[model samples]
Target chain A: MSGPTVLLTDAAPAKAASTRRSALLGGGGRALLGLLLPLLLAGAWEIAVASGFATGRLLPPPSRIGAALWSLAASGELWTHVAATLIRVGLGFAFGAGAGILFGALTATLPPLRWLLDPSLQALRAVPSLAWVPLFILWFGILETPKVALIAVGVFFPVYVGVAGAIASVDRKLVEVGRIFRLSPLALARRILLPAVLPATLTALRTGLGLGFLFVVAAELMGASEGLGYLLVDGQQFSKPDQILAAIISFAVVGKLADTALVTLTSPLVRWQDTARETL
Target chain B: MLSLQSLSKTYADGTRALEAIDLAVPNAEIVALIGGSGCGKTTLLRLVAGLDRPSAGRIALDGEPITGPHPGVGLVFQEPRLLPWLDVAANVGFGVSDLPRRERAERVAHALERVGLAEHAGRWPRELSGGQQQRVSIARAFVANPRVLLLDEPFSALDAFTRKDLHRHLLALWEEVRPTVLIVTHDVSEAVALADRAIVMRPKPGRLDESVALPLRRPRDPAAPASEAATRTILGALDRSLRPRDAARTPELAGGSSF
Candidate 1:
């Protein structure tokens, strides 16, 4: 069970070298592992439809879904829908997260501000995501404003909660370090408060983004004229199962890519975090 | 010189942590504050470091009043408290950011070298062991060249070997900068090894019971006859400090008895 010291020393560098090399290749390999289940299911459905085991009317085959997506892309209809969805999410996230961070910072640092706003905000947060859709439409009317507002509402609460909660839990010991260093208030916020809240802030942003995607679907389903949500509505009205499935797949793909982009962009900021996530 | 004139701290919750602590520490002297729990040793250090305000009286450093955290005063906490976002060099160079870029880099390099963490300058605080992190914290305080440095049980968490090893690094750094130190420690051996004068305190509105001046020279051995004698003397002061109020009379004030 035990290796000699000489043998252990000889094996260590070679093992380390191989593991280092595997790390680069392992990411793609891991991604492929994630695709395995979906691909298997698609393949099984394709064979089932091809063999005429069941009518592919209500539940379309993978081939029919791909064809529907391909035709939409060939005419550039897919890009229009994708762009519309992306614009709505981008605008909503930017507005919501900006206000969230600003208000969160204010409430956390000033006791009076916290006392004034925290209770009302907490009450507003109890309102469900979909429950606000009708109210937002009534407030902003049947236009882009309502859709964007809906998505913004979805993004705001999580970011606000994350920022406030993170600030609340920042280590007082670290703040005392700032005090001992004689950091000015601005310097204290810059050096301690900002970096300390970053990991949780990033998590909140990601969660808010996910909720934005959810609300974007809800927003588009109601009155969107040209979006993936619209495509869902169109397919349902026309009774085209393949087109609906294509829109669903597009949503999954675009949402996942957007999430990956977010993660990639913010990854460097929290590289210092010694999380258990790194152990894997 | 650092002077505390009748310094007292009564918490808002009605606990008088320290009562009328008056002391003057000359330049470059190391004073170890030793006592049992609730002795307000840490509170006294905190008040001196200016991290907290004393309810009564004031502190002066070189005739300058210290109302808050002063640039001339530094503190080492129980934990390292190094900024996790910063590397070892950056953390050590934190208080000295006002220096020119070249000078900051040079000073950080020098401080890292002093702590024997020169090679690990680029490593994050998380990568270092408890002892190494504490050493970086020590370097951080010393690199600023403060006139007074306060350490609140900075080595209580370390293993005995690491603790002894750190004492050497601390002394080496202390030799260079010669900051007046007020270290709060429970270890009698630590006080004996580092402190030029060990001060004992009694709890319940902590007051100074006695101050034992050590006559040992530089690089004193904890096991040496003079060091052991000093340790035993300070220990005697500590024992008498915890006794009932009337019985805490200094019966062996002039003696340095050894077993």
Candidate 2:
């Protein structure tokens, strides 16, 4: 708030240096504070196991969980389960996203299509994806088909709604400019509509990935033989807590990898957005 | 040449925009329609552009009845309205979608060079200054090589210096292209400086209030000694037209005024 004259004075450098030092020190203190709770929980868990209040078989120690992960890796069972889950999720997600984009675009561009489909879509989105698991199993049997169908249903609605809303909300001024230029309907959709809706659709893609995880776990819990989700449920049934903990860790790693893939794929399309928001 | 004969427009809510208006735009002449806000200046331009149909009357271009947007009419709106996703070159070439890819690229490049933005062809609208983006919009209209150019307050958003510079650029382009132009603006000085004929309009069942023939010398300088007198005369006429009916009787005007 002071004048530029004061900012340029001899004392300004010393004041600025002290401010920087204190801010760094404060951040270090907060980091240590954040670690205290996690450290205390780990310590108590180790103590409880030693005291025999909870047996190692029922509630495994952190070291036991780590050993279980290494053993699973050595046997190749962990990799096989992870690959199976990924294939199911990937195939289901690809089909769901493609269909969602086509239907969403069709509804947005044609008023008659929108009027016909909007009510049914609204009704479907009301039911949670898990609710469809039973019906999917009944229709397709307790095979891979049921699990894949559940994941697809879960992924579809968010992507469809996101793309449709983005298209419908496109700036009217841009459309007028298109008209002045005499852009054909296909050209207008490709150049004007698609680019405008891309940012929203990208966000929806991420949301669909998350829903795919939920449906995958639900499907595995009910019926499945060889997936990360099945491993977790199987470990629980056998009272082997170490195996369950290892499965959970692998699930988190898969999620992080999927997220990284999407981010890498769309980086070029969103370069403008990153530059615009650099100051913030 | 372009002509509007008894051209009229009424909105869906039945608000009449223009009525029984007649004007002839000869080849290579610039006509500026000046008016208070919502005096059907834009509506008239839209009607001429064939964006909206005239409720009554006819518009003709080059001896043919105009049923839709005239084939070679270039329109620049109040806002630059460039596509945010596109850079300068792409924005300029937007109106020439039918041209082959190679030809479109050549036209876009040429138009950008003409607008003095050859080096800025890769810059987005958000990346450029306001005046620069407006220039790209001007380039867009020019790239189409229109027979008649219609403008709606195209430079009203700019500062004085930018506006003046653009005025020069517009005139230079007009001289080269020799398109019949109709400009709608609220600034009286802008009208007097750019137009051979200025039409003043009034709102509330909007119609033409007055029309004046500008006598300022060719290639008129806005800062010249003669231009100041022209400015005041135009301003006085505008003041009389704007005044309440009771105060409009003391019309001490100097310019040739017609309706």
Candidate 3:
């Protein structure tokens, strides 16, 4: 027995050391590769505008958008709109994701609750999220309350779906392992259910956050406001194509940045995952 | 002692998985269960583990009945069933979570070292090979100091060499704690090498067919003549179990033999 064990230890660490991928095309390299095509397209659009190939009207080029953004930054106008949108999204996400996990866990563990809630929730899912806008404005008085509520509603469904689905799909075999250990229900949930559901839950949160941005546009559209959505409306009312393009570009960049930040923060939670994401 | 009294199981769909089975496994004895598919060997193991209900009979550990999983009993499945989110040490420590921190850590460390996994404690389960993962599960089972261990083909997925290696490791661990063990396996040599007796079963409504005692001494070599003879005897019993006529006719013949 000792002989075999000794042989195994000797062989395993060597294999582990060799499994490391070459450093040349690592994580940084892949990120840079992802940025390549978008940078090329943006450069091409900028040049097309600069060399007099197009009027650069109605469709402002990258340089004009950048200038618009730069002026907004210098005059401190961009900060106010950006701050409002971020706060609404942050608050809505906290509320929505929190309730999602709570109810998701409840419905998953209790069949009675699932039978009672799942059908109505699914029906509610079909109602266009924006359909709540007019009613919400009338109800909440065209304030931050309505906007945040709308964003929270947008963020809720996916997270709820994710939590319930993740819990339902957790491997029964692993649960048996918990049972064999005589784990208490609370300990079983903490030790097994929580970790098992984490990966999918984080994914759902990303989906919810993305929807938060989408609903923020609808929310700001409901009434007078300071936000990126307000910039979209403002640019259109004033007929400033440059500002509209700038706001649109800001939406894309800010959304991507927020998603990136989320993935970075939660990556450590699922670091034990043996998926392709870790390898590439 | 771990005992089953007239254990029987019938599923909801009108299938009799096990019927009228009686068994008594004394303390510190290792019993290997061998049978064809649907023989209810795994079903019997599950009953004893308290993971399922026995329709006709009850399982007892010592003098008390087992209604649910007990801290005194530990089970290992065909797959590792490890908590992939946890590292090796944490997985081993999971069963003893109620213990004092110092005692739990000490037991986990000792079990890991016993199973040749002390060096791999910090590593995630995904980083391990199939054999190593099984070893970690074995360590997890022992960490709680279980009095009876149930193994459901724990090494069935490994290669021949790895399986043989694991048999040795498992025996070594068994020798230390001497827990009453019930192992379900298709491998005849495994029965000869590890079990004190091999219980063969008949299928459909699975019942104990023959009990072949392997009186061979500890650290039995698979290639030795005594071990080969024991293996052949268990294989013969397994072969006879496939036919109803052969089994019903020879009720008392294989029950008394030892190699």
Candidate 4:
């Protein structure tokens, strides 16, 4: 009995190790598959341009787009535009998200404050960000303020709703637990409310950032001399298809990277919740 | 000591949960309130814990009227109710915020050690099994060192093996800390196995029916004749309380009722 039990135990870990190794290989294979379609498309585009089936001026080849990107990088124009957009997005996101969280906390916790400000905020939220653009440009006179404010307005509503709703729906039983332990109001907010609403709030922030990117493009299209949006307009004016494609590609890559960064930064805080969901 | 006098509770919609319930628990005594569902055992416990206010009556702790959540009272709910974000040590230390940092850590450690969960102190609540989470809740309650501890069916959710183990653990803790304990449970054997006195309650107005004193020694074997006898006595009282209502509904069956 002892010998057979020892053999079975030894066999179990070896089986587990093989399954883990296969899982890693499986992930890598899927990633390679994801790249296949894009590479094939690029190849087809290059072939079409080379064969003169598709004109280079209308739909630029992948090589032309690559050359355009290289020229921009060499001139240092790419870095300045990218940096400007990043700074605007960063500043606007901080301002809008900070105010959203504060207002959400107040409205969710206090009935009087909710009654006073919630309706007005809801009404304002219904107004489109574009509708604010002309008014913003008039009020702020094409300065950085109107552009930044547009992005902030775009980022504000989702975060506000997420935080307020999350706080409102916190488990009553857990709040009772806090009360039973004689937790002060501030202590309860810090320990219970904040942790409970964190996952939802982070999701809202991700969505808000995506919207921020869209608004930045719209803002830059108005009167901006720099940023990726300017490049798109400039390319359109000059009929440079390569430059337009480059701008669009940069947007996709940067948006993806920002979302990935947010997830990586917040994953540790929500690991317990994720594990609970998985087990369930 | 904990005392309740003529405690009654009627909901806003006119559902009477408990009526004129009177009881006195001496300090360091272990008492169990046993009843079927809707028998006001939990209502009584909640009133004592000051989680709900009595419609008409008073509860006092050592002659002081209980108003809100009192510092000397601790409660363990049916579910563990441990915060998922906090690890075991943090949950255990939750109620000891008034203490200095070092003292709070020591208290949390001591409580976890008592429940045999010191090794799991760094793990999240989700990482632990159901029994372990309940133990963390117990550790949380005991860490505060309250004068009166109220448990509302704390072990009814566990499996038999785990429930038996927790019963022993609870008794051992009671022996050490010696807080006045009021446990509300529906399990008759649990009542007989743990409490020095069991208060049997009945539904339809939810009043106390009888109190059975268990003279069995500590470290009781539930299968022992004495423990079995106590269980039978409490079950018999519950049966009697339940019989009259059934008899009233069906007159024909009441004539030959064996119960």
Candidate 5:
């Protein structure tokens, strides 16, 4: 038993190193595999257009969407729309996620506050993000205020739920350790509670960010111009399928990029956590 | 010195976990409370550490009554219980936060070095093996330089070899710091090996059954005849403590089986 245990323990580090190396080696191949299906769909669409099976004017071939993107970029229209949408998302996400974390922490820590707030907030969360569009437009008008506020409202619920749940579910044993050490309530929160809940909260923030884009699109659709949502509406009004496809594709790319950026930013904070992995 | 006077603990559900437990440990003495499951060994340790209040009695450290978690007491739970976010050095320094920064760092370093984990100061708790993590927990408990150290089956989770190694390490640390130590464990050999006195406890409204003094010299060998005899004595006491009062009157069971 001793001999085998020693051998197994000695092999563990080497096994971990090999696993890390394989992960690094497989990164590019995994990314390529992810892109394969989308590329196949685009190719098939292009072939169908070329074979005249679908009219290019109605469906817009891959080439036409690419050309639309190029022209939008060259004329600087793409940057304006992208920048407008991104600013709203950035501002709204900051406000919503910030408020969510604050209120969630308060409610989770204080039983009376939780009792007073959680039920109403949960009910409000059940209402669709679009339901607030007309009300926000009427209250704040068709300016960026309504759009940003709408996005904020959309971003708030998931983050609040995530943070509250995470804080409530922090390991009781760890909390006992803190109490045994005689940590002050504030010190306990700063040292134990915050770090324990961070991973789940970051995941919630990412979800909220995705929802931020969706709400911004809905908000922009109801009101006046100057966003990817505006470009999407403009394309429809002019009956240009290429422009519409261009806007939709850009949204998808931007959303993916934003999610990736968030993951990169949060990975280091939660590096100590033991995340689940797919076995090879 | 640490003293527990008539300490009793009764849950709200009308179950008595401990009853009139009385014990005392002079300064720098090592004592072990040995018992079976549901014998309130952990409850006694917790009460002594000021982590829980006794229902009907008092625990005093250096003649001061313990009302809540006090600086004079340091506790190492059965689990290492190191906060996952903190590195080894930070975990060691956790209980000693009132010290000056440089002093805290020095104490943490000294404790880690004493536990033979100096090089692991920057590693996370998860990166360490179970034994190493337990060592870190010992480091944390000792770094505070408390008047008393409470260990609740601290080595019971480790494999036999690691457990032996930690016993040696714990003895070394005790020799160096010489804090009054109360270790709660069910392992008879462990009590015989590390403790100056082993207090046998009985279950079902836990109470002290007997106390056995170990007169073996330092660097005691677990396989030695004296240690084996002591282990047998404690086991015999524990077994006798477990038998029903009426059974002791029966002729056939009067000469109970020896361990």
Candidate 6:
């Protein structure tokens, strides 16, 4: 038994390495193929335009989009709109995340409070953020309030649902362990439940940030003079697709930045996730 | 320092898991609760751990009846059940936060060292192998320096080699701390190997069937040939309990060799 076991053990590692090498090669090949796809599509689009199968106004070339990006950067107009959009989204996210997490925790812990608050909140959540734009204009009269409110509404639900679900999903065994350790209810919640749920809440925060960016653009499109969304509208009316494409590229860039920042903010809490995924 | 007076449990679904059971575990003694599937061994362990309430009985630790989980009681479940978000050291220090920070760090380090996992302190639950994870669970239980440690089939999921290694390590740890231990297990060999006194339990409205004092001495070598005789003896008793007619008729049997 020992001899055969020794033989198998010695052979297994080599077999495992070869298999892993082949799997990695296959995965890398697929990744290279995926990277080439967007360039292929852009090249095809340019060819179609050259062949007169599509008009330049209908489908702008990648080169034109690049030129628009350079022009916007040179004029400093992109920076102005980007800064305005960032401030609004930041304020909306901070307010919405704070309020939503507080109410979500209360609702999750107290059944009576949940019964009173959840249905109304669910109804509020059902109304699209854009639908609230007109209502907010009626209330706050179309300044920054409507835009911020729209983004805030977009931001709230994800964080609220995330916090509540995280709290509810805490392991009963860990709670029991806390009880055995004689931890107070507050202590248990702080030490065990809070830490356990933080990863989910942070993930929700990242997702909410992305949603806020999307809605910031949408809200500006509906009515605003100072944001990337407004830039898109201005570009469309003036027939400057370059400016439109430039605003869109800037939006994508900002969205990526916000995502990266949120991930950085929550990195410490999710360090375990990083290490676990590292092995694979 | 633990006593159960007429401890019985009936599930909400009307199945009686345990019925009118009386048990006492003296301080620092390791008692193994052994039985087949659905025999209420886990129920007994849970009741003692205060994870569940008895349907119609009382459990007391050192005289006072327990209404809820008592402090200084550590429990290790079948699965490691380590919180996925925590590293090995954090998982071990999970319940010991009341101590000073320096002392907590020392205790966490010591516990991990005791389990031979000091090198793996920064690893997450997913990073470690199953046996290593279970060892971390054991370290978590022991880190509290609990007065009463209850293990419910803790090694059941492990392979035979890892299970044996853990049994030896557990006994070594028990000798050091000497908490009142009550282990629940279905494997007769495991019960016989680790226990000082093995209590056989009957299934379906479960009750204590027989209690046998292990003939093998403390710090017995699990790999030694001398241990096999004692193993056979315990297995023989377990075999008798498995026989349908005799188990139903007698309900309690001792000092009989069925094999």
The candidate scoring highest on lDDT is: 1
Choose 2 or 3, whichever is better by lDDT: 3
True contacts kept of 5: 0.59
Per-model TM-score, in order, reads 0.93, 0.86, 0.92, 0.91, 0.90, 0.86
Model 5 error, position B85 (Å): 1.3
lDDT of 6 at B235: 68
Candidate that beats the other on lDDT, 2 or 5, i.e. the better one:
5
Per-residue accuracy of model 6 over B73-190 as CA lDDT, tens digit each:
7899888988777889999998887789999999999888888899999988898988999999999999888888999899999999999888877887788888999999988778
Cα lDDT tens digits, model 6, A74-193, are 888778889999999998898889887998899988999999999999888887778887788899887898888888889999889888888888788877767766788899888778
lDDT for B34 (candidate 2): 81
Show the lowest summed lDDT stretch of 10 residues, model 4 chain B: B250-259
Q: How is the predicted docking of candidate 2 categorized under the CAPRI scheme?
A: acceptable
TM-score ranking from best candidate downward: 1, 3, 4, 5, 2, 6
DockQ of 3: 0.72
Best by TM-score: 1
Q: What is the C-alpha RMSD of each candidate to the true structure, in Å?
A: 3.5, 4.6, 6.3, 4.9, 5.9, 5.4
**What C-alpha lDDT does candidate 6 achieve relative to the native structure?**
0.83
lDDT of 2 by residue, A1-280 (tens): 4677776796789989998878866878778879889788877887888898887767787778889999999999999999989988997898788878888888998999999998898799899878887788789999899898888888899889988888899998787777676677888888787778887788888888888887788888887899999998889888788999899989899988897788678867755553642332
Worst 10-residue lDDT window, candidate 2 chain A: A271-280
Question: Please, what are the lDDT tens digits per residue for candidate 3 over residues A1-280?
Answer: 8999999999998877665544535777778889999899889888988888977888888788889999998999998989998999999999988988898999999999999998998898899989988888889989899999999999999999999999999999999999998888998999998999999999999999999999988888776569998999998999999998888888888899998999889999999997755442
True-structure lDDT of candidate 4: 0.87
lDDT per residue (tens digit) for residues B1-259 in model 1: 9999999999999999999888889999998888988989989989988888999998999999999999999999999999999999999999999999999999999988988999999999999999999999999999999899999999999999999999999999999999999999999999989988888888998887778888688788877888888877888878877778775454332332333
Alpha-carbon error at B22 in model 5, in Å?
1.0
DockQ of each: 0.85, 0.40, 0.72, 0.66, 0.57, 0.39
Model 2, A194: alpha-carbon shift in Å? 2.0
Choose 2 or 4, whichever is better by lDDT: 4
Q: Better model by DockQ, 1 or 3?
A: 1
In candidate 6 chain A, what residue range of length 10 has the lowest lDDT sum? Answer: A271-280
Give the Cα lDDT of each candidate: 0.90, 0.82, 0.89, 0.87, 0.88, 0.83
